[model samples]
Target chain A: MKLVIAVVQDKDSNRLLNALVEKDFRATKLASTGGFLKAGNTTFLIGVEDAKIPHLLEIIKQNCESRDQLVAPVSPLGGSADSYVPYPVEVQVGGATVFVLPVEQFVQY
Target chain B: MKLVIAVVQDKDSNRLLNALVEKDFRATKLASTGGFLKAGNTTFLIGVEDAKIPHLLEIIKQNCESRDQLVAPVSPLGGSADSYVPYPVEVQVGGATVFVLPVEQFVQY
Candidate 1:
């Protein structure tokens, strides 16, 4: 068995879960937060047979999507109106940031 | 040091983090999944002084406001075109689901 950990944007959790359940796959959901951006995120624990990797990917591909967000640059120039310029930065956020690792053992009792 | 774990919607992660940084708090972000909803969620580990609970809560209250979301009831009626009820159920999603636990030991070297 393999445990797949996927970190995705919160906006897509509902659709993602529904799709998983539809496929008869079970996951353990832990409420989580992101350290980098301090945003709300969901960390999932999924145990499945090695052969099911493709299925998991299919579901992730369908639900977890990436997108862009606008954020202000951390180091904004400090100046009066005459010298100030808004430092607007765009960043890509979302989609699946997943980690697949070998599990030594998995037991549910 | 206390480990404050907050599970929140992905939509609010960025804002939430910004608020924390603004307050000089540092957190660890982990990607997670929900067992019930099978959706995407973020788990955060925030270390703070015990006295900072109220401040943490204030930030959560500001960014993790709950909202209604529409989900389909699991037991969808069969019968193709005739026996059908969309069965749209509105559920509340979002807000901080936090767990504050005492750490037996903490070390950073």
Candidate 2:
């Protein structure tokens, strides 16, 4: 078995979870945020058989498509506070950061 | 920086998160269920400096305490349907499974 760790935007989590449920793919959802954007995101931990990885990825891809988001710039630490006008920059969001790891042991109990 | 992934019981998550926040540690919370008990659990993804791993663990230990849970036994697939009556079994739950991984890239843009 493999553990699929998928990080997706909050907007996409509901759809993704629904899709996974429809296909009988069980996942654990976690609330997360992007380090850069500081926006809400969701992380899913899915335990699946090896052959189902591609299917799981396909489902995630369909639901978590990347999109442009406007975010205000955060001032750097120790930087001059004066003349710091925040600009809303468009950055790509909604794509997933996935990590697949091998499971040495999976005990239900 | 190291990414600390902690799987804990739902009952303990709020306190754990609060404790971490008090210490200026940022974490991402995920909703999960145990495979055996099918009870709600929470997974926390914390980004921390390596030196503070011990402290983080201590905080987790203080918040997420393991306890016994009563779960109904599930009958095996293809077993006799009429003869199977599930009896409640006491099992341990609520301890955290933590994974510490090295982060090659830590970007805040």
Candidate 3:
């Protein structure tokens, strides 16, 4: 068995969940924030047999799409606080960052 | 790379985070809940090199420990509501559920 950890934007979370549900795949949702963006996102913990991975990835791919977002850049370290002008830069925000991990054991009571 | 995913009780989260930071290991906190108990918990995503796995696990082991918790059991399915008597059952609540997953790729932008 493998555990698929998909970190997706919050806007795509609901849609992704619905898609997974329709395919009979169960998921555990975790509220997370991106390390770079510091924006809210959803991390899904999905356990599946080895064979179903491709199908699961397809579902995630179809649901989440990358989109441009404007974000203020962080001030440079050791730079004067008053002189720094934060500019809103456009960057891709929406899309799923996925990781597939091998599960040593899974137990439920 | 290995991503150490640890699901721990909310009570032990701060302590665990502090311990990881002291060791210079960065972690991302995710708000999660247990499947069976449906109680709030904290899931940490810690990305580390292959050699540091043992140390990370040790820190988690030392910080989180199992504890007895009294919880009301869920009513039986299809059972009549009027006849059911809710009883508080003692169950082990604390401790970390850890998963170590291999990362195919790691990126930061």
Candidate 4:
């Protein structure tokens, strides 16, 4: 058994989850903040057979496609201050890594 | 000097993010699977001052309200094989714990 951990952006989470459900795979979600942009993100923990790692990774890849997001500089008011500029950033916000850890035991009741 | 971690249902994530943005606070979201039903969830990590902890908790409480979600037993095939029941579970999918860690160094560049 292996543990698959993936961190994804908030936008693509629902679709990614529904797809996982359709595949009958179960995962645990954890809330974690980012060190760079300090934006909200979702982390998924999945337990699967080692043989299925590639297949599961494909699913994650298909779900975590990158896109452009408009981010404004941090300011007290709505970037309404003198430094307010709606800059379009092509953020590669997708699956950071799939941590596959060997599980010593697996049981469900 | 605290690390507040919150795990919330996926359904309520967008609204929560918006609210946090409105409050001018940034959080990190992680995607993780669950131990119970193996469902999808969104986790948020926020670093805040002790005095702001209560205020942040209130936002989470207001958003992470209990709700019913239908889950089926895991099977190679859908529960449609033999049994299928749309069960209602009042899952308390909210902030599990807040880990406040004292940061030895804090810097922003």
| Cα misplacement distance, residue B35 of candidate 2 (Å) | 9.2
Candidate closest to the true structure, highest lDDT: 3
Model 4 chain A: lowest-lDDT 10 consecutive positions: A100-109
Q: After superposition, how far is residue A7 of candidate 4 from its true place, in Å?
A: 1.5
Q: Which prediction has more favorable TM-score, 2 or 3?
A: 3
Chain B TM-score in each of the candidates? 0.70, 0.72, 0.72, 0.65
For candidate 3, write residues B1-109 as lDDT tens digits: 7888798888888898889888988677886767522467888888788999999999998998777878886887798888676888888866888988787545331
Candidates in order, TM-scores: namely 0.42, 0.48, 0.52, 0.44
Error of 3 at A40 (Å): 1.0
lDDT of 3: 0.79
- Across residues B21-51, which tens digit of lDDT does each residue of candidate 4 receive? 8887778876645632423566667767667
Fnat of model 3, as a fraction: 0.36
lDDT of 4 at B30: 68
Error of 3 at A20 (Å): 1.7
Worst 10 residues of 2 chain A by lDDT: A100-109
Per residue, candidate 3 scores C-alpha lDDT tens digits across A38-91 of 367888889888899888888887787577788888876898888776887887
Q: In order, what fnat does every candidate score?
A: 0.26, 0.13, 0.36, 0.28
Q: Chain A vs. true chain A, TM-score per candidate?
A: 0.70, 0.73, 0.72, 0.71
Model 1, global lDDT: 0.69
Model 1 lDDT per residue over B7-52, tens place? 6667777888888988999987776555523246676778877788
**In model 4, what is the error at residue B92, expressed in angstroms?**
17
